[model samples]
Target: MTQPLLPDVRRPANGGPKAAARNRAALIVAAREIYAAQGLDAPLSAIARRAGVGQGVLYRHFPDRDALATAVLEENVRQIEQAAAAEDMSFADILGVLTWHLKESAAFLGLLHMRGSVDHSEALAHALALSDRVERALRERLPDGHRLGAANDLMLAVAMVSGAAGGPEREARERRAMAAWRLLGVEVGTVRPFDA
Candidate 1:
């Protein structure tokens, strides 16, 4: 594959591949924490400070703020995928996992939505691919109901969570939406044809 548009800085004498990897990981963690506390508009310098790394180190791993946000979001999506794939997890369980991630990563999600048009286009593609995979997996486990595909219901659930603020309000909003899905029979571990 072609090289990414943003490349890391060349390793110095004291820093090798291992150091680069560690720095990259640290940047992601710091970005998540900083973003959660201060929103996506928080300065990149703040994230660098939180990671205990210099601004140059942060820039080496992620050339721009969008790059950093994408890295954080990619990690979040991977985690949600793993949660959904857990043994015996129902659709409701999967939605819970998804919303929880969404709530926690609201800043990143908002950043993506606000910067939807351009910039970080590749990251946007990767995020969409990850989401599509999860949705397809969930769809396979859901039965056709009300002539709607599982993906449709999944989108609606996402829309519901999109309006939610962080903290208890987020959980409450997701719970209400899940309850509505239950009423509509848009869940797994039910009398759906797939389970029969």
Candidate 2:
């Protein structure tokens, strides 16, 4: 038999119920907000209460906060992958996608920088795979003169603040975003100066 163009991989056949996706997504958001406010010490029961779902229902969907946290990150990763799917964008446009990703996902990054782990290791693995896709999109989007090194630099710059500062230090984070813009080749310097 001739080999097919792409390798086959096994995954869940079911995407799950549309309503369930919405509901689980809501639970993930609620957990993130509560966890951001109180860290992981916040009770799952309280999260269930805040989510307006019975404890069993919450457990059925997430089983534990670990699963819930992973789900949140996964959702963000999915969006990033989707947005960066374009392979023909100009370097600047591609860079814009990176900036928008980490900015819109500031809270998600905050959770990651703060929480750092989830029970299901596979979730984090999937997140990283999605990141690779983002990088690929960036490389494909860059102009003829652009070096891959710039893409790496942009990734680091975005992480420098969000992955480092996170939390109530809103001003500093904004500085990081602006710095990231500059690093991505925009001429503007730190719009609001601040230390890392």
TM-score of every prediction relative to native: 0.64, 0.58
Per-residue C-alpha lDDT of model 2 across residues 1-196, encoded as one tens digit per residue:
9977887778756546975776676787677556655665678887778887778878989877667766666665555455445444445544444444344444456433432455446755665555555556555544465443554564454455456435444456556766655554553321321111
Candidate 1: C-alpha RMSD to true structure equals 10.9
Worst 10 residues of 2 by lDDT: 187-196
Q: What are the lDDT figures for the candidates, one per model?
A: 0.63, 0.56
Clash-forming residue pairs, model 1: none
Clashes of each: 0, 0
Error of 2 at 5 (Å): 68
| lDDT of candidate 1 over 24-140, digit per residue (tens) | 989888887777667778999999999889999998889898788888877776665665566677665665565555555655355333323465566567666666665665565
lDDT, residue 82, candidate 2: 51
**Candidate 1 structure lDDT:** 0.63
The segments of candidate 2 whose C-alpha lies over 4 angstroms from its true place after superposition are 1-18, 86-127, 146-151, 169-172, 183-196
Q: Which stretches of candidate 1 lie over 4 Å from their true place?
A: 1-15, 88-90, 111-127, 140-151, 166-196
Show the lowest summed lDDT stretch of 10 residues, model 1. Answer: 187-196
